[model samples]
Target: MRVILALLLMAGMARAGSDRPGDFDYYVMALSWSPSWCALEGDARGAAQCDPRRGHGFVLHGLWPQHETGWPAWCDSDARAPSRSEIRAMVPIMGSAGLVRYQWEKHGRCSGLAAGAYFDAARRAWTRVRRPAALRQPDRPARLAPAEVERAFLAANPGWTADMVTITCKNGHIQEARICLTKDLAPRPCGADVVRDCRARAARMPPVR
Candidate 1:
């Protein structure tokens, strides 16, 4: 009986962090710099978003549900996956169908929203934040401090403060601008983990093709 009780307690402990759909405190909208991404990785993958004709700048990365601390992911949900048409429609903003599907499987599932609603919510959140014009179409590569990038975003969007936005870097390139928002999509202060601003003194910002 003691052995059985021990096993049951172990099972309960294992389930403590199990992701449940729609059970998070807020959201984080991640916007990627297209040129920086292409320079670092997308070119190797022959990603269409890297095409010079596309002229993509800041593109939607994902809208992730967050907790005050550690976040949930890959929650099992009865909600159907996005239809092919739905996935394709997001390509202009999200960059690829694979990303659309992958995000749904990972962060989107944890949102507790069905695939369509989740994508729609993501779109709504994306549209709400204005991209900085200076970073949108630079004709030449420039090195900028992460704080400068964050300031550009803060300037473009009123009502957003320093605590609500963060800049992240990868391989010496400015990667993405992440913003914290309430569940309803209003700007909010980021959690401790989400406030990890990139420490790069002058990360490269590749020019838009």
Candidate 2:
């Protein structure tokens, strides 16, 4: 009986964090504000995305695999890593090849896709959402409520509703906009854990370079 109970406990533990590939419920496509990232950590690291010439606005952060109540990360997969050329190709949209590789190892691996297909899916997900053009062209810094950001996104993307998106902040600066999507790339309502919108009355938005 003792041995049987121990085996059962081990089985439950194995299912907890979900390291298996291709075994998740949905995706959260995170779009990071390039300016905010630069202000926060990218500039210090001399990240190429922080270069003024890049003029990046919202860049693809990652497409994360989420369970109904939790998330999976760093899943074990047999897929090969993305090639240098492939990584470089994604830089215009994702800001960094390093980030591309990291996202693949972490979240993309859980998508049950090869590196190329995973990246393609991420690209498709990004293309489906219409980023607010007004926010992209801001010539000066501004403070915006988190709801205002969500409203802008909802206005730009017709099918997206309030529960489908959330705006996150870091260090008083607008951070990332996270949107929930089905495996087929259609917008969906976020899970409870994914709907934690920033409570800040106003968050700083640095202007595009």
Candidate 3:
């Protein structure tokens, strides 16, 4: 009897471990965000892994450019950005049309309206950090460097200039940064060598007037 109980307990644990709740969401989202043939070699491509289970696709490339190193890679994994479409898809449909039925059938009530609402709000809030295509001119890659970009932004925004700049470059691409802004939340470039004043300004933006 003891051995049987132990076997049953072990089996239950294994099932729980292997059955990750969000795997379908990850894969489906990856398809949405990544290029059509992104799985060419089976390695996760670009920033897809950040939303490894499900990606917002190239739509997010401009919003959060991929850095080849550091924790920034997992920024989306924390649920910072979920595509609006992905949010709509998750509650009603999971892996595919087929998954809609499967998720409902299997778990009976795992992730329901609550999870859907949570991810949806996350998607909306992400738009603030999301860089619009108009803002990012990737075609002018040759002429643009992160530092120069910061200066230009400073000029454009007046108060919100680049306060710090940390360039995460690999394969000749500067990935992302930790920007500080003026009291009005005007953006400035900031990084490791950035000054305390910039950090202070960024840290304490004036309330919206």
RMSD list, candidates in order: 5.9, 5.5, 15.7
Quantify all predictions' global Cα lDDT against the true fold.
0.89, 0.91, 0.30
Over the stretch 103-164, how does candidate 2's per-residue lDDT look in tens digits? Answer: 99988888888888888998999998999989987889999999999999999999778999
The candidate, 2 or 3, that scores higher on lDDT is: 2
Q: Give candidate 3 regions above 4 Å deviation.
A: 1-126, 129-141, 153-161, 164-167, 180-209
Residue-by-residue lDDT tens digits, candidate 3, 41-67: 124534333333543222321112111
lDDT of 2 at 161: 88
Decide which is better by lDDT, 1 or 3.
Answer: 1
Looking at candidate 1, what is the lDDT of residue 205? 91
Q: Pick the candidate with the highest lDDT.
A: 2
Native-structure RMSD, model 2: 5.5
CA shift at 11, candidate 2, in angstroms?
18
The 10-residue segment of model 3 with minimum total lDDT is: 24-33
Any residue pairs clashing in model 1, and if so which?
22-111, 22-112
Better of 1 and 2 by TM-score: 2
User: Ranking by lDDT, best first?
Assistant: 2, 1, 3
